[model samples]
Target: MNLERLKQEFNSKKKSILGALASGTDASPKGSVDKQIIPIMELLNSCPDAVTTSSCSGRVSVFLEGRKQSSTTSAPKQEHGADVAAAGGKGGDGRWLFVTHDHLSDDILQEGQDDAIFLDMVFGGIPSEPAAPRLLGQLSSETRYIHFKFEPMILHVLTETLDVANRLLTCAISSSFRESGIVSPLKNPVVAIRTMGLAFDSPVGVYDPERNMIQRFIEPSGLKLLARLTNDRFRENSIRIDSFYRNLLSTMEAPETPLESKQTRALRKKVEGINKGRGIAATRENRVEIQDPLEDGIPFLEDDM
Candidate 1:
């Protein structure tokens, strides 16, 4: 299709999708945009050349993997509440044991408690333990693993053209979202801003159906460490998001300048140092200051774009 025709179609679709989202008729599993990511979403949607199709403002979750269904077997229905589905998982059978988009506090991690009780406090349920023989028998069956994941912010934006997508991708990568890229460039170009390096995922335990118990692979201390690291990543993710938004707005305002210039590279390095907690001092001429959105509050106006 011609570029103009494509832009027309893209804009039409974007309008419909945004309308649905605003009216709470969004077809996404969550049925609405994440509260934390609304500013960025609004910014992108306000731009005439781009619009966000989907996004997540990062999350910490404990997911229970369900048994794989065969061609003959139907998928199991989910019995959990809306929060479980909102966390995002494999399928209907797989559910989130615990999930939160907000940062976790260290107070949630208590020491000296029974592993089961501690897990119950964190995951909202306590699985019953069975006899040794029964446990052994259940271990031989299909293993259902529970995973703890710290997912970073991810956003998908559809742009009017590849140039617009590339500009957004540049801003994303400069903000330390190395995984950001133009996912679809030939048709309606789509830019995905994300970084797997900020994400954390580990198998924390396994479920025993025979015993109706969850066997934790890590101790209380280990879990505490994981929580601490996840929180650290959460803070970094917020910083990166704020940086990306600022960079994108600047790029939009000054589209003539190349985003890969030396100044941009120097700024990216400073942002990287901040993300790593290095506190590296920037040069006098090329300094770039970054603030934590979770701490100092969002610096940008909601309708800045």
Candidate 2:
């Protein structure tokens, strides 16, 4: 379905859960919810028990802590802490975001008198529910186009409902082991199909209307989508025919200096000077042998006569 219809479906489901919680009723017994509820439930399951510096991976949580300070100043205050170590700010922390496959089922089962509390337990904080249309605007097409929109919304609920400052910093790498489809090396291919972090103002929970950007990585077709985003021929980073030809011509005409100028000169001098060295050496014994041998033979012959 289109974006509008998908959003309506999510809101209706969300309101139902909130209503049940408000009325002090359990939405359902555990695991009795719709199939689309997996993402949110997984998000809930991923929350950390306490803050620690372990290799925790899940979804990052962003929230406001401490009492509200004086808001009467000219500049407003930020809700979430600002630091790279605190990568749980608004607009998401990094190039990735995730929604568990089992979010909705858990939300359905856990929406009780303490539903908000339960949500906080799952996500980091309860964000102000933005206007429905605007909220839809924040959800990327990859998420909206899903056959089950509840999956992503449930994930958002778990992330937005957490009572702590952060959640597990996690992600799902798509599996490369698909049977018929492209069997990429991805571990969790479908996770990429979900929308990324929602853009809002600083402080994590506040939904600023104009200051937001939505992003998503769709699997199976993600490469195609990426090609579209980066295929701008006019972009400088893209290959240019004219530039490539010009570079080729310049390289062809340029003389390749394999040896340095000093080395070439030294080699030439070495070759020329090699011929000037001594070819052979003569000794005085050769001259003496030619002159004395004749004199000795004449004297001996005269005596014999």
Candidate 3:
């Protein structure tokens, strides 16, 4: 690949990104694009083999998806609290009780609600969604929610070489964990990094107002701790991402191992980090220590994923 040509192309694209950012047209409901990675993005774009097309630092959201709603197409969360119920059914899509880039505070649980409250989505710069109180599934009026999407920082890099892409992906995976990220190869050649969070692809079982006993197992303090931990993990993931690209730029190289080798390395690194606090081997002889936290009294060991 022509390094100089790549740099020129990156510069052009970077210019457009900066222009759009300056014009305040990112269209993200949470806020303007994150300022944390702009410098890192600039540095990467200056390099010959990389250009960023889009990026997000991360976000935490509380939303309820309608039966027909697709995960990728859900509406933005409500910013104004007072109108959450009245406006809920108004929106054609799902509802968001809370959405933010920063970690939620302890007072989050204190947000008051009334009979089927709907959030207000009319405010400028706030993502707008039609009100729909029916979208939420809750049996008890007393129970609250701790749902969140702790997406870590994600980025799209247009690159020119397999070597560079593989190296970035390798380090990024190890740094963020295996499932946290992936690299997309394209005619334009893009490196897409997706970081993970506590929230899975789907919601936990919906509250059944008609039958299921309200799961009193959820504690406010525990939920708050979970939120805090998830938020902290999200930030930690972002830092890892930063370290990946920044180290690549400075060193101008990454390990040239096979994909699986890189994957194993990253996995081992993750296990090592986790086991720093306690000893539980996740690979080789002690691999079973990970898959099954406890063994039966029978003392039989089996392979599992």
- Best candidate, TM-score-wise? 1
Candidate 3: segments with Cα more than 4 A from true spot: 1-15, 67-92, 106-146, 180-186, 197-219, 252-305
Error of 3 at 304 (Å): 30
TM-score-based ranking:
1, 3, 2
- TM-score for each candidate, following the candidate numbering: 0.72, 0.17, 0.51
Instruction: Quote model 2's TM-score.
Output: 0.17
Give per-residue lDDT, candidate 3, residue 168: 52
What lDDT tens digits, residue by residue, belong to model 3 across residues 63-176? 543223223433553333333333222233345655666655544433352211212210112222322355355333322222334666767666665455555555555555
Tens digits of per-residue lDDT, candidate 1, 1-305, equal: 89889988898989887887778785555666678788888888888878887788988888887664333433343333332222334553677788888787656665664656556755548463322544445553245677888999988888888666655665777788876656556777877777778887898777764666777776667877788789999999999989887876676566455333444555545544453452344344356455444442211112111
Report the candidate with higher TM-score, 1 versus 2.
1
Q: Top model by lDDT, which number?
A: 1
Give the Å error, residue 154, model 2.
23
Backbone N/Cα/C clashes per model: 0, 40, 20
lDDT of each: 0.68, 0.25, 0.48
Candidate 1 regions with alpha-carbon error over 4 angstroms: 69-89, 110-118, 128-141, 255-305
lDDT of 2 by residue, 1-305 (tens): 45455445544555555555447563322313333333334333333221111111111222322222233423433444232112222222321122332212322333243444533432333222323445445543112111101111111221121111111111110111011011111211111112112112122222232334222122213322222322231132112222322332332244652111333334334422431221121143332222221221101011100
